[model samples]
Target: MTARGLIFAAPASGTGKTLVTAGLARHLRRRGWRVATAKAGPDFIDPTFHALAAGKPCRNLDVWGMRRATLAGLIGELEAHADFVLCEGVMGLFDGTGPGAEAGSTAELALMTGWPVVLVVDARGQGASVAALLKGFAGHRPSVPLAAVIFNRVSGNRHAALLADATARHLPSLVCLGSLPADPGLALPSRHLGLVPASENRDAEAVIEHCAARIGTSVDVERLLRVALGSTLSAAGKAAPLAPLGERIAVARDEAFCFAYPTLLEGWRSQGAEVTFFSPLANEPPGADADAVYLPGGYPELWPDRLASAQVFMTGIRRAASEGAAIYGECGGYMVLGEALIVGEGQICPMAGLLPLVTSFAERRLCLGYRRATLRVDTNLGAAG
Candidate 1:
């Protein structure tokens, strides 16, 4: 049977969409359903929580960065493996990279996959006014499927009743799943990037369980399942997004290097590449026989002391580089490959010295968004532009 899917979106960010999505995924998984979760943008942190909750790796669906075929292939793969798929949207339901551009928005994903959206509205402040908000979202893009609504941070039964009555009166077509109460304990802690990586959170599983219990009790799980629609995507004859680095690739995997995209690795495997993982924080090095090494992005600055003291890991990577193994580093990984890293209080931390570069995190400067650059010369990434 084709897998049914739902897009858990919100009017804006911080509307408890991540917790709700994770909670619903866990709730369904506990009930004997094979639940698969995905984040609907370029997010590494949220997917970690979803993976923890769903007991599987969460793939990212980036409409802007990924081609249509790649997106279809991923959704197809998810459908083939799981009975149900839940996608957590990024930011607001309609918010994207630019004004009126649907490229990176949740609405775009919903429309593309023909998946019904379960709008999670934060009902903390107003009651009847929410009806107007719902109406605007529903009527904004007539093509996007807005199947149901779920009230979050609801005050009490009276508040829920007020919202429900307002919805029934103003928009009789939209379905109200249920309301989750305002519980401060349900909120996840955040850092500069976003929520702290699930691996770093000691009570990650407990937090997921708490969310699952709350959602299972509050939301109408049966109706929510019914509201999910099957994906309209077909992945027949779709090509992999990019070529693998080498036949055998060794990847850095630890708290500091946790921002690797699962889809990219999965694509590499699909293209007949062998991938292995090692932890630099644990003083582990890449496999000796690895033809290529990948150091992904993460909070390397946070563990500069541990990384700097990992002599074994440093020596191993240097050996690999000298032996002509393709070494690729992105963001935090690039920082580790530098000559030194200036972290907290301008402390100099010795790095792998693979690159004549130094990165400083002493004063944070947030540079976010998509970037496009043409390669100047032939390298591991691609040929010259």
Candidate 2:
């Protein structure tokens, strides 16, 4: 298929790639272009912002959690839906799990999908040195081609001209799309997990509008659109979402349990499974007829007391577990399934007590990585390995 796509990558995180990508999505959508947006890592927050900006359901293109076929199928779904697809890269373009590990990096996705990457550089302090950085990024991996460069947090036109002229002199092959000015107000507010969830942000639409207005004035939308449309990936027909865990699946979705992957939910529907949702924070419970319940990861520690006293929700979960309904938890959800949770010093809250696990958030230790495991027994997910 001749569907075009572009990857917005940066030298590092916090370099304004998300803002630029969101802004560009809105700008293009306003011009009557059907834009498909995707995030290039295991992030759920950015995609929400992307969806708000593009007026479409944003999807994640994670390299670590998905197989090549799965990624290809998701891209194909986008190709079938929208004329142009724009993706925001994670962390640094090449920074990933290991020194050449291709599982969870933007560079790997670029190579896998053959999508051109536009380097989003933070140009707050340096001038000519910006060219040096772009040169390194362009040459660091010969397989990953750099289509263009857009400088973020630029001081003024003089600074942008310096970056442009230097890039023209040193790396004439690289295109300089332009630069965004330094605007502290443009930064999105954040909680523990990065930007606050878009659903909770009262000024979310205003934020998107601000970014779109500024980006429309700062960047060359026409040239950027042409470049994105030129880099097309061959289509792989959409694959069905993973099979449903049960005949009727009940999911907990709230500020405390909102990290579920949209692809997984869509997959369940594609397989003709019925899916339902409830909010634990709102004292809601799973449907009485649900055969399975899924609690995804989120900030359970933030409201231990509220969750502990959620009698209706807690009782429904226990009742479901007693009825032999399949129950699964991930990360914070896993913590909530335990006997008790240590929220702070001298404070503990009783939990569902479904599992022999106790979680302590007071200590504040971080565990972050990709996991590989084989089920030792038959479970609702699938047969044992």
Best by TM-score: 2
Candidate 1 TM-score, true structure as reference: 0.93
lDDT for every model? Answer: 0.90, 0.86
Q: What is the per-residue lDDT of model 2 for residues 218-254, given as tens digits with 9 covering 90 to 100?
A: 8887787677743334455445467688989999998
Off by over 4 Å in 2: 229-234
RMSD of 2: 1.6
On a 0 to 1 TM-score scale, where does candidate 2 land against the true structure? 0.96
Collision count of model 1: 0
Tens-place lDDT per residue, model 1, 111-144, is: 8899999999999998999999999999998899
Summed over model 2, clashes come to: 1
Q: Give the TM-scores of the predictions, in the order they appear.
A: 0.93, 0.96
